[model samples]
Target: MFTPSYHDGVIQHLITDVSEDDFNVAVGGQVEIIGWLYQYYNTEPKDRAFKKKKYLESDIPAVTQLFTPDWIVKYMVENSLGRYWIDVLQAKEDPRSSREIAEDFGWQYFMPEAEQSDQISVQTNADSLSQADIEDVTLIDAAMGSGHILIYAFEVFMQIYEREGYSRRDAAKLIVQKNIYGLDIDTRAFQLAYFSLMMKARGANRRFLTLDIRPNVFDVPESGELTSADFQELLQSEDEAKQLDYLLDQFRYGNEYGSLIQLDKSVDWSMITRISNQELDEGQLSLSSIVLTESQDKLREICAVGKILSRQFTIGAMNPPYMGSGKMDSILGKYVKKHFPNSKSDLFAVFMERLRSLTDTNGYYAMITQHAWMFLSSFEKLRSVLKADTLINMAHLGTRAFEEIGGEVVQSTTFVFKHQTIANYIGTYERLVNFDSQQKKEQAYLAAVKNTDVDYLYRTNQANFAKIPGMPIAYWASANLIHDFEVGTRMDELVDAKVGLQTGDNSKFLRIWYEVDNKKISFRSVNLSESVKSQKKWFPCNKGGAYRKWFGNYDYVINWKNDGHEIKNFNWPNGKQRSVVRNPSYYFREAITWSDITSGSFSLRYREPGSIHDHKGMSAFSKDHELLIMILAILNTPVGDHIFKILNPTVSLEVGNFKSFPVIKNKTIEDKSFNISRKLVQYCKEDWNTFETSWDFTSHPLLTHIADDNLSHCRSPVG
Candidate 1:
């Protein structure tokens, strides 16, 4: 018997208040309300609830669940599923025309270069498959958080069936029974998904519910299915543990071959059908459920659910969860590392591997996930694995891709990669960056879908990527530039690259220029350069400040009087050091420093003697001052910034990324570079001293000169 417990038990509560005219609208509204409630409960204090759990373990699904917007769902479904159907239809014709192509796919065909390829319509020989063969195509949403993607895919499958002369009612039933599959780790999500899919069928035929509809949706593992007694019994028996492991292996194999085999009497349903109570007492294992009944009915239901998920999909779509391995529990982290070492940096990366494996040959896998894998050094191995497949298209959206999420959320990118490794395939990459808001980001995304000519869009071969030092998806690099990376020497070879000290507690040990008691921020009752009678507390510190170049960002003083004893002893509540002090020997040494975080290019500034640099600005020290200035000149150039963008795409300027900078080791070139850099620094210093903000300045340059047309065009802001 089919145990459809979720639809009647949990789903009814979710859609109770959702009474709208349109089906999609009603579902969307319910989801919005559900999401809002989840957010509220997740953020609220649990202490006020009278010693309840600080946060319910069950609420994790709601807290993390992000609704896939309607437009994005359509974009994903159409490109993966819709494109498949279009290719099939095109194959039925003897000769395909641009006009027919324009009429049929003009709205979706954005890549003009790919449009020119005659093979664009010829995805596979299977395109000429009969209607019956097309019906066998399986599509799954691996993460299926409320079944939004699967629901839209249901509508598309209905259209395909309808085109093959099936009525809407029959099409809906067939689509649910054969075409769609969904899996989610969250039971609440599975419940919503099941309810939403059932409602989709109900929308077509009111009498559809009266007939049995086995919607191919299952909650992964169904943690609540087995009782504590059942688990304890299994734990006690080594034979039962081995049997369970074998069952899991069979389940995995079934996913790959389930659809290929017919589910008939030839298969042994005996394990599911026949269960004896004696086996439990005798320490023998069987599929009988301890919680439900000692019969095959419950076992059969679980087996059926397992049968659905054990099949591979022709098309997969999802917005997988965005969590990193660092946030996972130790057990989960260990399992992920062991299973998915190549993509273990983040949960989404692991899903990318899982989704790809779930797809059959020539199948399309499309997802919107954190974009870090494309460029981060840690994910280089994962990128290599992706390079083995065919990249269909990508929409790389920078930070603030999601609404109401800011400050330091992972940036997002939407991409579709096929399981095939076609060498000549050219993928379209639309780089949508610097959008002011989530609304603008969506608008920009839709523009890409419709094939509007916009900036930051390019079409490149997959072979061009993952070839550089850090394996950056250098979609923006020219042919000449890519060649340069292959032959260039890295910067760390020339200079001694080192990050500065981390004071641990800046407020206690450091103070701004204004916060100091004297002209400088001074510690009370402390002596400076010479030894003090009382104590020594204040010292000039070179913490990285604003982005002005050569001379003036000296804005703080640090208390390193006793060799940073207080900071070194400080510990956080987590038992970790509150502050990290590295390379203390390099303190008060002349070096070139730059802000670790900046809005624009990484600006290298010079630091004078008697100043300790902080972690905010990493310092590059050289015994030779001329060599340091040369490195500074190289870093300040547009070429240096362009390379930095390739090494580390994000705003963070890590020493690791800086170490990869290509340097020229020729003495002649170094001398010339040093001379030019010295002149530039002198000019910047002169400009700095001219301003009243400079400690040495007497008057402002603008006050000394009368205003003119030249001054009007280049006016500076007044305080």
Candidate 2:
């Protein structure tokens, strides 16, 4: 028999140092140690696959399996499984009594208010349920990873089992057999998850060490040569093919039911062992020989694997892996596109869709995932679906939420939702933002858990999200702002907003005026309405510059020699254009432009008619100059900035972000805004004209004084 006491090199050091007793209490830390080890090993694999534009099959689990912190796991379980019991208790509580009374009666293990009301339908007049009913509830973690969720759930199940008067040993065995279930794609992750749950059970009842008990954690079986050959042989024989067909149908059921395969509830261990022993001598692979176990021990493992197959869980909790569509392998990318067409932009979004399939009716699921799905336009359909569900609670844990993940790697949000969709569900949303360091983030999280009064933490309703165009779950948007989204018209209708031209090679096609010798070529920045060119090699280009409003950022020029024909026609040896030209009509058209990358705030400046715009800046154009000025004024205002931030939570703002913002066009307001913008533009124009850059000037006033020295011709103003 192969003992369960085996450690891979990745976690050998940590596993060897920890005794069984230490491992039980420190399971959370052990999970973290393994998570870091996995991350360390896959760093190179991730980089290699990214460089090669392929996903390394070997590292899929390693790349995705993150050790969800104990607190997050607890929050998910408490809100999900704990809420299920609370729902039963609430339904049984007196209609006139407060929820606090239900908690006081030990009917509710976790606070009801902490989760969404849609999870449980409460009736004060309903019949009371016994403790045995609580133990009957089942739970699973779809992406179980190191089984932290299941391990913690085991603790919760033990509490329920004990409360029902079951012995510790019996409760431990029952919890593994009936309550906890898990599935992970990675075999290594499945092993850790299975071991973690076993350890958890052993802690509850040390007698568990003597029994041939197995935790209901399973992995997708790798198709090997032996299994393939066996299947082929079975298909060739009519009698064997019938058995194969039954098994295949059961496998399909297993997938639909939550198990990776149809697990045999009853196993003839003695016969299985005999067959295994026979197969090994014949140089064939068998389950018993593969695991190197015999008798009831191997049968228990087999039975445990089946327990999760074709089973529905009452609760699901996971911190699903994060991978953007750009990083995904073509196979997974296509699968996501086919199944979850709306949220296929990111792998995390796809997992959000996948999570919906893992729970039973009225089952609750809780996850901490990227907050982008809550607002991005690509996930608009996803939001529409999720909003209909009973969103129990949301904690918007924006950037720097994870300590081990250095810097502001992911802006995260943790939420709990029930499987059922209730029309009148009210969910609580808590905002936790502006944490500069990891310590601050941790402190804020602790305070939120304690339900303490933290200044940054505030609450909102789930219904408020529906008013927004994308149904953005903007928990922080005030009631007034929500109303604005409902009433105002989107800006795309009022202006021609778009990204500018792409000079495929900036180094070859563009230059600062000082970088090249001055000679009349084909470039000039003059009124394009009338044909004009400066007698210089470089013509002005609007490549985005510093944060100044109204005007400026005209320091660049593209070599438009031969009227841009040579630059436009340039191509590489592969027959791909070395230079790209877009929006030819928009070029040299007077417009308002802004840099795509901003310092958390937006600044828009005017680009004159003679300038060619570059991709670094996006532009909004209109023949109605006054209207464009009015739009510019609105964008610079506090309201515009607020809307932009809500539409795009990230620092990077694209043209789509601009289009999403609502335009409040009141003629009276537009007239005044236009006047302010016109004045600002003129002031900026004078500032530009004051310098030697003014093309109309023969020579700089200061230089004129030094060259002439004619006291009479000192009409030049110099102090």
Candidate 3:
């Protein structure tokens, strides 16, 4: 049972190098240090998985491990578990705002409901809740990685027990037994969570650890060889034996999907819950061999997970893993695609749905997840089911909110979700994105809560989201801007916009115009027939370039000889067509174009009559050239910038980003935009022509001003 190597290396390292400093905290005593340590410990594996460009099923936990910040955990729990108790208190005629009650009860992060007059028809979700007695109240962190949320929740449970006049000792045990439940995919995390919880209990009561207490926390196990036949001897009843299949089925991908696994509703776990903890009889214990005992242990553990999963909790506080569908392993990708279609874009959105379902309809669930779900078109279906009024409050914590994650990619929003008392609920939203660092954002949030006019704070009816094009949670969008969609015509209707074609191998069929013979490029060909007649191998292609308006970025030329014979037929080793030749007929058409993506600002430029648009060089075509110019002018204005910001604020501006762009029609060029656009196009073209790279370059503007005879006066008009 003893290994000298373990004692010498592991024991010696800890005894010499580790001490109380590793575990001790200055405030929030007995804090979940395990979560932080786990993150650090997992650095090597996380880096390894990321370096590989793909994740194995076993690496899912390491790859997606996010040690939720302490403040975020508190916010999630306060708004969810804390709000549930406050709702009951308010319903019982406490006559205090939720924030007031929460602060008095030691929950500072809880935001109060907006004050509404009695004239409003909306009702609070409190009326729908079954007021489970204090002991019956339950909370679960389904994806409780290192149990940070659960540890904070423990303190809240202790507070509730004290208010109800229970002894600290009794409350500690009961809290572990009935109040909090957790599940994680990683066993290392589960072990750390277990030790942390035990230490927490021991801190409350010295004798707590001495008792044979097992908190309702379990690491989802790999269902290796978990056949029904294996449990045949362990389970006495025929029905109980058959029920093993359901439990086993739920854990088929346990290594890949932890608490995200939904238990089967068909299985009745009442008897399983009762007999799951049965002690061995004296006769059986003496007679049983190792195999029998192991089987019994496996059955009990499986039943415990099934029982916890099947129960609907009063509250859910979680910081689930974050991974996109593209990065997900095969098993998980297939599971989420079939099971969570609406949220299949990312794992966090999937958990948002899963956790809400695990909660009672009247209960609350709060989480900190990628803010993309709030506005991205991919998650519009997710927002549909969770109606506007379901929102309680949100802290839109955009990028740089994590200590380790320093980029603008991992943006986040933490919020509470529960049905409101009324139809049109006014929810508070704090836009803490402008600030950097976790501490600064937390400070800003506190400041916003204290004073509503903190610039970033806003109180608005969430029902207004439904009036928008795709139900974006644009809490900061002005009322007039939102209403404009009602009277506006979407860009799809006004202009014929397309994403354009893609050459699978840009290197093979593309060349900088000057890189090849000038005579081989068909710069003046207006149509495919004209280009073929010219006997040119290359034609100008409108590839995306720098942000500029009107007549520039005449970048590269594509090999369209014989109607793009090479690009059109480009195939992969798997016999799949690789080159995406979209809108072939629209090739060589005079259209307005723009870079598909930009840093912040947007601009549209004119495409010459003879060019094919690149995939990134998106184009909009119209038979009426004046209408096209008018739209181009409108797009270059501040109005187009505002629309892009409202619709999608991410770095990549997609083709579909403008499909919902509203355009108000005006004929006769009443705004004189048509003429201004024409003049600007000419001015830009002249400026462009003066540059050496331009195909129309005659001479530099500086050269036109000076002549051999007029060296003294230098009076050319261009001067």
Per TM-score, the best of the predicted structures is 3
Error of 1 at 80 (Å): 1.8
Give model 1's clash tally: 5
Using lDDT, rank the candidates from best to worst: 3, 1, 2
lDDT digits (tens) for residues 1-719 of candidate 1: 12356466445644565455233443444444443444344344322332433223343354446776656676678777776555566566626543354345433432322543656435565543423256688898877877878887887787678767899898888888888988776666678788878877888878889988779887764223333244444244555444433443343422222221122222233333333122445454545534434432334544665555455788988888765665555545666687689998887888888788878777788898888887777788998888878887777777777665676446788878878887667777878767766677667766765564677678777787755676677787777777776677777776767887786778788876556555333323222233133245666777788887866676777766566667787899998888888887677777888888876777887776557778887778777888889888888888888888878777677787787777756888778888988988888877887865555576567755756665654556765
Candidate 2 residues 3-113, lDDT tens each?
354565424655677555434354445555555555565667556655645555564665665566556667678778777666665465534333464344343324345
Candidate 2: worst-modelled 10 consecutive residues by lDDT: 253-262
Candidate 1 minimal-lDDT segment of 10 residues: 253-262
Q: Per-residue lDDT for 325 in model 2?
A: 76
Instruction: State candidate 1's TM-score.
Output: 0.76
- Each model's Cα RMSD: 8.5, 7.0, 4.6
Q: Answer with 1 or 2, whichever has the higher TM-score.
A: 2
Order of candidates by TM-score, top first?
Answer: 3, 2, 1
Where model 2 places Cα greater than 4 Å from the true spot, the runs are: 1-53, 94-132, 224-229, 232-311, 445-461, 502-548, 555-582, 682-719
Q: In terms of lDDT, which candidate is stronger, 2 or 3?
A: 3
Could you tell me the lDDT of residue 150 within candidate 3? 87
Q: Is candidate 2 or candidate 3 better by TM-score?
A: 3
- Name the candidate, 1 or 2, with the larger lDDT value: 1
